[model samples]
Target: MIKTIGFGIGLVRFANAACTSGDGLEGVCRTRRECARIGGTGSGRCVNGIAVCCVVQKYCGDVTTSNSTYFANPNFPNLYNGGTICTFTIRKLSDDICQARIDFIAFTLAQPDANGLCATDGLTITGGASTVPTICGDNAGQHIYVDFNGNSTIQLNIFTGIAANSRVWNFKVSQIGCDCPTRAPSGCLMYYTTLMGTVRSFNYGTTGNAAMTRQLANQNYGVCIAMQPGYCSINWAQTAGDLYSFTVTGDSPTAVTTGTAGTNAVIGALCTTDFVVIPNPTFTGATPGAANVDRFCGNAFQPLTTNSKPFVLTVVNDANEVGDIGNRGFSLDFTQQRCNNVPVIG
Candidate 1:
C-alpha cells in the first residue's frame, strides 16, 4: 500500500507576530484556534502572552508557504515503513525570494545499488535552475542549495521501496531573497560563506566494505565558497586519517594517487570517470612541467592553495559506478587566507 503525498506551494500570508519557540525554533504568534487550523503546535506564549507561539510543521501531502518551514516525514524521527511515496511542494514566501536551502537534519533511506544509483529509495528535488542528483542513504548533516528564479515553487518527491527497510527523513527549508549577500551561486549544489569550513561529499563518513557504493551517481555541480572580505587566497587540504578521503576513482579505495601533495597536475585519462575540479590552481614553492593543474581525482588528495576569486569547487560524476565500487567520496577542509601581499604564486 503505497501512500502518495503531494507537496506543493501555495499563497499564504505571513504571520503578523513572529516569535521564537522554547526550543529555539522560529515560530509565529497566533491564537490557539488559528494555530490548530494549520496543524501547528503551541510551543510557548507570545505576543506578550496574548497569543501562542506556534511552531508550524509540514508533513507528507502538505504544501507550505511559510519561510523556514520544517518539511518532515509523518511521525518524523521515527522510521516510516517501506512502500510509501511522500511529496511536498514549497512556494516562495514572496516573489523576491531567489533561493531555498534544504538542510538534512535527519535523513536515512535505503542505500544505493552497486552502480551508485538510488534504485530502491530516493529523494528528488525539482523546479530548480540547477540539476540535483537523486540521493539516498544516511545524509544527516548535508544540505542543498536550489536556485528558484523563474519558478515560484519547488517540489520534493520521496519514493520508498516495497522492502521491509524503514526510512526516516526530516529537513528544514529556508528561503533566501535575491538581495541577500550570502545567497549561493546559480549552479552550486552546496555553498559555504565562512572564512574556514569543511566540505564533504554526499553520504560521506563511512569506511571499508560498508562504504562501497556510497557515492551518488550522475552528479555535476559546484560547491562554492564565498570570498570573505580582505581574504586573497584559499587553502584546501583533505582530511587526514581516512584512506578513502579522496577516493573518487581507482579500483580499490587506495589504488591511485594523482600527484604528490599538489606537486604535479593530474592527467586527463585518470579523471575520465569522476573528478573534482579546482579551477586555475596555484601552489607554493614548486613549479611543475605541466600547464594546467586544475582537476583532481583518485584515492589521494594533494593539498593546494589558490587565489581564485569567488572561490568554487566543481564535482562531477558519471552515470555509472562500474569501477567505482570502493569509492567512499571526499572530505576537504578549506581556509581563506588574509591578504599578505607577498605574491601568492612563488
Candidate 2:
C-alpha cells in the first residue's frame, strides 16, 4: 500500500526533496538559510548530502500544512498555566494525503470530572473521519489516527478552563498518504504496529486526587494491531500490580471475577455495558467452558491468547458510570507470537 509522498505547508517555500533529521524525525530538504528563515532546526543532509534536512515545528495559534510536523503548547517543555484554548490547524500537504497521525509525546491537563467527563479540560479534534473523544488527564505516549476522507483541513484544540493544574503538551503530527502502508485501517482510533506493546485506555495514568474517575464514559472504538508477518497469535496479559487497570464495573451481584474457572469468568452476555472484546479468547490451563470467555469486564483480565486474524480489539463503554464503582479503566500488555513453520521434504 505505497502512495506518492506529498509536501506539507508552504510547499513552495521548502524544497520538494524529502529528508530525515538526526533524531529520526521526517523533514524536508532545505538550505541552511531557508531552514533558518522558517525557524526549523537543521540536521542531517539531503539532495546528495548538500541540502539540510529541516525539521519544522509549530506552536499554539500556528497553522501548518507540512508533513511530519511537531506542534506543541506555547512555551513548551515548560508548563502552560494559562486557562484558555490553544489551537493548531493542519491543512493537507497535498491532495494525496488522506490521514493524520498525532502522537502525544507529552500530555497533561486538568483532570476530568467525577463522572469521567472532560468537563474541566480536554483535547478535541474537529474535521476528521473519526469521532475523537474529548480527552484529558495524563495521556503521554498515546497516539491517534485520523482519517481525512477528503476534508481539506483538521484542527486540534486543547482547552484549559481551571487554573490550578499546570498544563503541558507536545505532539507530533504526521500526514499519511492515501494507501500508505503505515496508515491505519479505517475506523481504528488507535493502532499499534509493534509485535509487543502495552495498550492503555486514554488518560490511563496516575490520578493525583481521589475524586477523579479514571474511566472516560461513552467511549466505543476499535484498537487495531497490525499483524506482523509470521505471527499468528497474540497474547494479552494484565499489567501486574496496576490496580486501576481493568476496573470497568458490572452490575452488582454479578461480581467481578479474577479469571477463575466456573461462573467466575465473565464472558459474552455476562458483560452487559462496559467490556473489552477479545475474540475467541483461550485461557491457559483452562477448565471446562473457560476458553469460551470472550468479552471481559468486571475488574480483571486474565492472560488470553487468540489467533484472531487482522488483530482488532474493541473497547466498549456505556455513557454512565456505576455508583461508586471507581471504574479506572484497563491497561493491557500484548505480544504477538510467531508461527511455527515446518519444512516439507520431497
Candidate 3:
C-alpha cells in the first residue's frame, strides 16, 4: 500500500506594490502586482503566484508527457483554457504487503473574500464522471481524481478566486489494501476491553455496579443481543422496589449468556465500587459467525458482574486475506465516552 514518505511545504507572500496594468477591470487589480502578491520570484510569473504554478507543474510532470497548462489569469471567462498542474508523491513501505488502489484525491480550498463562503469542483481520472461543485457554506473545497494503480504520481488542477495568501488546501488520499502481520494471536478469547472508572472487584448484584451479557442473538448482518441483564436493574434507583423497572439493554436473537469468571470466560474486575464496564469484544467483519470468532474467545462473556458495562462493538478482518476473508474480528474499542450514542452498532 501507499505509505507517506514525505511532504513538500511551500509558501508565497503577496507583492507589496499595486497592480498597474488594467486592461478593462475596475478594481486596483494588477497582473504584475497580483503575481507578486502570490510570492513569485521573477517577472512573467503566473497571476496566482509561483506556488500554484509550481504545484501544477509538479503534479502534471513533464509538459510533453501530459497535455496541461496553468491558467494565465483569474479574470478570464474561460477560466481553465489550459489545464493547471497539481503534484504529490506516495511511497510504498513493503513490496508484497499491499498496493495502492486509490479511487480519488480530494482538495479542500478556503473561501473567497472571507465572507465565509466556499465552493468545490472535481477533475476526472482516466474516464470517470465529473463531480459537481458542493457549496461549503463559507468554506468550500475541491477533489481531483488520480490513478494510483501502480504509480504514486498525482496530477490535476482547478480554477478559483482563492488568493494565494488566504488560500488553504488539504489533501486526503484514500486506498484499500492489506496490512502485514505484526504479531501472533493470543489463545484466550482476545479480550479487547476499554474501561472508564476503575476495575476494583468482581462482585455481582450491588448498587452502582454494571455487567455485560451476551446470548445467541441473530442480527440482520449478524445477531442482535438476545437479552440485556443489568438494564432493568439500573433504573430501580428512580422507582424503588420495582422488579418491572429492571431492564437489560436489549436482547440478541441468538441469545448470548454470561459464564462464571474463570480462564475461558470474559470477566470484569473493578478497582472501586463506581461501576466499570468491560470492553465489548470486536469482530473482523460486518457479520458475526464462526469465522468472526476464530481468532478470539467464542463460547463466553467471562467476567460478569454489576461493574461491567458494554459500549460499542466492531469487527475487523485479518490484515492479509483477499476479498473479505481477512475482514473478521472486532477491531474497534468503543467504550470511550464519545462513542456511546451512535445510532448504528457496527
Candidate 4:
C-alpha cells in the first residue's frame, strides 16, 4: 500500500489493465508502465509481462521467548506462490541454558517435480550453537519435533517452489521442556534412526560416515544443489545420470542465483561467511577426507550408490534452524541440471 501520489488526483491508472488477473490481487500490474503507477500492498515485480506484488508472510521475525502460538505461510492452508524466499532468526529466552524446541504441528514440503530433485525449493536451518538439521521433504505429510539443544540462536531459511505443490506448515514455539499439547492424530516425530541415504542436504559443521564417504574423489566437478526430502533413492543401480561428486559453489542466494534445481545450466560460484569446514562438517560425497556427511549449500554432489555399496546409503537432512512456520514459498527449477552426475561404471 505505497502511494506516492495524492488520492483522488487526476491520475491515469495503468497498474492493471482489465484483461487477465495476476496473483489474483486487485492492484497487480503486468508491465513496467503499469508498475510505474504503483498498486497493491507488496513490492512489485514484472514476470513475463505479468506483474505480481508478492506479500511476504508477516509473522516471521527475530522471535524470542514465546509461550505457545500458531503461525504459517503467507496464505496458510492454501498453496503459496513460487519465487519466495524468507529467513527467520530466533533467539533463546532470557539467557536460558536450554534452547527452544520446535514441534512441527503440520509440515508439508513440495516433492521434486518432473525435472528431478528439487535443488532450489527447500527449508534450511542454520543453528547458532546447538545444531538442528535442515528440513526439506515431502514425506507424505509428517509431524516433526526437535530440540535445539543449547544453541544461542538459530536461523530459519525457507523458500517455496512453483505454485503447483507448495505446502502450509503449522508449528508451536516453546521452551525445551515445556508442557505442550498432545501430538497430532497421525504421529509425532519419533522416527529418530537415520539409516543409509542416497540424497541428503547439509549445512555447516556436519560430518559423514565411511559408507557415505566412499564415493568421494577428484573426478567430477561440484555443483550447487538445494535438495528437498522427496527425492530419496534406495535401490539405485549404476544409472545413466547418477554419479556422486561433491562441492559447494557459493553461499545462500548467490549459489542459486543462476542455475537452479531444474535449470539446465551451472550457477555461478559465490560463497559467504566462510568456506565450509572440512572433515568434521562431513557431508561425504564431496571433499575427500573423512566420511561424507551431507550434500548441502556449500558442498559438492557425488553419486554414492556404487556397484558394490549400491543400496547401502540413506538420505538424511542434517537438522537445524527449524523454527519458522510462516513463509510465502520457495522457487525450485531455477535451473535444470544442478550438479547432475555422469554415467557410472562398476
Q: Which residue ranges in model 1 land beyond 4 Å of their true spot?
A: 1-20, 23-38, 46-52, 208-211, 254-269, 284-290, 341-346
TM-score for each model: 0.85, 0.83, 0.20, 0.34
What tens-digit string does per-residue lDDT give for candidate 3 at 1-346?
1111222664344432322222321112224433344333232233344312211111323221111212122332322222343333343333332322221122223321111112222222331122222222111122222223354333334434333322223333332234523211121111212232221111111121111211011111111111132231010011223221111222211222232212222222311111112233333233332221212222222222221232222121111111111111111112232223434343
- lDDT for each residue of candidate 1 in 246-325, tens digit (9 for 90 to 100): 77776644363334543322434457878898877665435442347677886666777888777999888899788776
Regions more than 4 Å wrong, model 4: 1-58, 62-64, 113-116, 128-133, 139-150, 177-346
Which regions of candidate 3 fall more than 4 Å away from where they truly are? Answer: 1-85, 89-108, 111-159, 162-165, 170-177, 181-346
TM match of model 2 to true structure:
0.83
Candidate 3 weakest lDDT stretch, 10 residues: 214-223
lDDT of each: 0.78, 0.77, 0.23, 0.34
lDDT, candidate 2, residue 154?
A: 94
> lDDT by residue for model 4 over 1-346, one digit each (tens)?
1322223655333333222234342223334433333221334453333344432122445344333323456666675665677666555554533444444655556543222223446666676332333344343222233344456666677787666655666554544443333321111122222232222222111222212221111111111222223322222111123111222232222333343332211112232211221122222233332343322223223223222211122222211112211110111111112123543222
